[model samples]
Target: MLPYWRLSGFYFCYFALLGGVAPFLSLYFHHLGFSAARIGELVAIPMLMRCFAPVLWGWLGDRSGQRLLIVRLGALLTALTFTGILWRQDYLWLALIMALHSFFWHAVLPQFETITFGHLGEQSARYSRIRLWGSVGFIVTVVVLGLLLDRFSPAIYPQAMLSIMLAIFCCSLLVPPAPVAATRSALPGDGFLRQLWRPGVLVFFFSAGLMQLSHGPYYTFLTLHLEALGYDRVLIGAMWALGVVAEIILFMVMSVILARFSLKQLLIGSFILAALRWLLLGFWADSLVLLALAQVMHAATFGCFHVVAVHFVQRSFAERYQGQGQALYATLSGCGGALGALYSGYSWNALGAGWTFALASVAATLAALLLLRWMPGRAS
Candidate 1:
């Protein structure tokens, strides 16, 4: 229980940093006078870095058998490098800083996940109970920061974010290392690339990538969109928190859901929810109730999808390749997210909000179709 608490604490701080960045950063970029396209580029660059960074770091962690050290180094370096943002406001400099920070920050999680599951052992079904702390942290941060931004200026955003990162780094110091699983050596010689190239894996990556790509517009422009619609920062923050709160509830019950549903079923359900969610946002941005309800779907769209996907990776890959398997998940999700954000930026400028969101709806639908066609009937 102490170990679980410690692991949960690490996630709490880690996601607190995310809470600041994901929900508020667009508003910050807006205040910085960045065009929508520029803001998208800024947001997407870090995600693009995530596509490759985790894979490299995961590989190294596996080779050295020092997952904890990798996690510590990644967190510390991420915090230190992000401080560079304070020294530069220029888009190019900030973009470079974001890329550097994301390169390190992205590596921290896949290895940490490997460690967390290791700690859970055969009781892995209880992962959601421990992981729910992250959702709680995200909700708390978004609500608090929303109030802060409403009362103050956007200039303080980076400082607030830096403080969270520093806290995350400090928390990394407290996380006890887990024992290496003995089954690490029993992994087959199927080769990483070969496994990655399998038809089902390839289809899964492409479909998941499309799903994330569709979210690019939402992540890069949601706050800005709300602001343009006359919503206050606090309200926007509430919307973000509302979604995560739903996610927390889902996490609390995830073990039961997983027991009843196949991973494919969860994945397909999430895509369908995502389609409806974007459509709601596209057409009903002015309706607080509708928007809030849409946010709640995040429970299905992200939380359930993530849990099932992580479990699938755990079941499919051997213990030795666990880090790499997680890394691959990060790569597709991150890179796809980056691409989605960037493209959304351009489309938002050119196509307008309604059409941009409509496109996202299309992407989500396509992902659902692909999942129906490609995902195996049974959990892999």
Candidate 2:
């Protein structure tokens, strides 16, 4: 049996840190007097590193069969490195800190995903149940910290984030390593490269990359956008938490969703919803009703999308190559997210929020089209 709670505990703490970063980090940079472009650059640094860092770490984890060890190391290094933010306030210094901190931080999750799946074995469909704890963690942090930020200064953000980082390090220690499958006596004739180059696989990755690309604006500046629209920090945080709360509900029912729907159906639906969500945020920022409706789509956009993605990756690769498979997904997501952040920064500054998110909508629409073209007939 899996050490369910231990694994879930790690996710809870890990995403609690994410909750701290995603919604508030830009606000922190803004409070420090950085412009939107600079904030985007700083945020993109970690994501840019994620593009390559995970593959390297995934390689080592697969070869060494020490994924949990890598997870601990990543957690410790990320926590240690992020503390450098306390030492400097300049853009260059912050960028450097982000680079160093992210290099290791990005390495942790993909490998941990591999470990979690390995633990689940044939019961892989239960992943969302284990994963929902992370959403709960996110909701807790985003809401509580949002309320706190309203009362206190945004200066408290760093200390609060550092505390969550410490918790992640502690969680990393609680879970044991996953058991390895015995190697096949004979290797496949097609090999890893051949499998990766397959048409459906390539399309899946390209489509997935576009999906993350569409999230650039949402993740980087949604809080600031809300603030600009006259919303308070508490309300902004509640809005962010609302999205995750919706995600939690989806995660709870994801097993049933998966059992009924094909991965193709879920992926297409997620992209379509993501496109609509971005459009709503772009044009309807002032409408609390529409904003709430858009937030609720997180159930489809992230929750359903991600659950299907995890399953797709697991089914795509051979047992021994699971680390690499997850790593590839992480790398592609990082690439999309990095580009999204970088461009969204420039677009938010030059073109404004509406156009920035409109661009995001376009990207997601393109992804859905790609999925439609390649993933037909429920083969997935």
lDDT of each: 0.83, 0.86
Off by over 4 Å in 1: 26-40, 87-92, 150-153, 182-184, 197-199, 224-234, 285-288
- Which candidate number maximizes lDDT? 2
Q: Residue by residue across 168-261, what tens digits does model 1's lDDT show?
A: 8788888877765533453467766766765567777777778788887787678878898889977887787788889999999999998888
Q: What are the clashing pairs of model 2?
A: none
Question: For residues 1-380, could you state the per-residue lDDT of candidate 2 as single tens digits?
Answer: 68999999999999988888877788899999999678867876777898999999988887787888999999999989999999888999999999999899988998899889888887888999999999999878877898899899998888898899889999988888776652221165756666677657888888878988999999878988999999997787678778888999999989999999888889999999999999999989799999999999989988999889988887777656667778888899889987887788789979999999999999999999888898756745
- Candidate 2 displacement at residue 240 in angstroms: 1.8
lDDT of 1: 0.83
